[model samples]
Target: MKQLIILTLASLFFTASAAADEALTAEVLKEKSLAMCESKASVLPEGEKAEALAVCQCVAENTNYELILEAKKSGDDSVAKQHMEETLKTCKAEDASIGS
Candidate 1:
């Protein structure tokens, strides 16, 4: 029930991403990233731990967010890190869920 509520609150913050760029805001991208990262875990009301949320936030802030989404869609997971290597490293150092 708690996980459901957390997911529900996350849903209220952002819808699923479509292929369209305009529909994918930074906030939306962060949520999508969080969902993918923690599909098997529970999150806080803020959607993630501070470190993980910070990582996702940094990833979302990148101009190439669509590229990461595109790469993931294409099964080219390597490309997802193209623009986020630094953020990943930094966040991982902090033990962020998405970073791990």
Candidate 2:
């Protein structure tokens, strides 16, 4: 009976750990991407308002806190800027992808 209980507890702990890991990964992705997008939007020209808005939308959709922290640490401004631009383009290509 004691052995069975120990095995069950071990299985439960492992299952919970897996779920937490998945959730953390998703959160990280969203945060990092959003920070980059926000920065990009702030720098866009007035004539490109629509595209800038799309960048913000994509960041909201795709960002996570963990990823943003990583990006900040790397100090890769150009890469982040390019990423935001591509995200804006992708949002425009998928109708109804932004401004919802």
Candidate 3:
């Protein structure tokens, strides 16, 4: 009975730890995406920097972190590049509509 109790407690502790790790992983992925966006936005001309940053921010906000992680693990950047292109296209359309 004592051994059963100890095992139960150990299982609970491990389950909680795993959950915390998963949450941490998600947060880290989000930070990485934002950093990537910031890096991409930094190359824009001074006049376009703000709009570019906004586009990058949108990309970071809309990106699928899980797909990004999978692509990273597989050493495939296509998914990430696709996301960037889509974000830029959308932002450009918005800018055009605004007469910018």
Candidate 4:
């Protein structure tokens, strides 16, 4: 009986973990990315908001979230984070709407 209870508890714990992972989908990540970008861009002039949003959207769409997820699961985001920054740079360069 004790063994069965342990097994049930373990099962529930893993199930909950799986559900949490499922909830962190790409859309959720994108929204989070956009929110962070919005907060940072808030300091910019009001006229640049649209360009900032465009850059944010480009980063969110171009990023390889699988790399981010792997980093999350493995607890090492250095490289994945670098990739995200690279994406940001690329997006900013491509937009050419802000910064003069």
lDDT score of residue 79 within candidate 4: 60
Stretches off by above 4 angstroms in model 2 are 1-24, 59-90, 95-100
**Candidate 1 ranges with C-alpha deviation above 4 Å:** 1-22, 41-80, 96-100
Native-vs-model 3 lDDT? 0.51
Top-lDDT candidate index: 4
Instruction: Compose the digit string of candidate 3's lDDT tens values, residues 29-55.
Output: 556556655665566567766665565
Q: Is candidate 1 or candidate 2 better by TM-score?
A: 2
Residues 39-58, model 1: lDDT tens digits:
42334455544544454444
Per-residue alpha-carbon lDDT of candidate 2 for residues 62-98, written as tens digits (9 for 90 to 100): 4333333344346554444454445444554563553
Off by over 4 Å in 4: 1-23, 35-44, 97-100
> Which pairs in model 4 have colliding backbones?
none
Each model's lDDT:
0.47, 0.44, 0.51, 0.57
lDDT of 4 by residue, 5-53 (tens): 2232233223323434776665566566555555656666667666666
Where does the lowest 10-residue lDDT sum fall in candidate 2?
1-10
Colliding pairs, model 2? 27-64, 29-63, 29-64, 30-62, 30-63, 30-64, 31-63, 31-64, 31-65, 32-68
| Cα error, candidate 2, residue 95 (Å) | 4.5
| Clash count (model 2, backbone only) | 10
TM-score of each: 0.35, 0.36, 0.47, 0.59
Query: Poorest 10 consecutive residues of model 4 by lDDT?
Result: 1-10
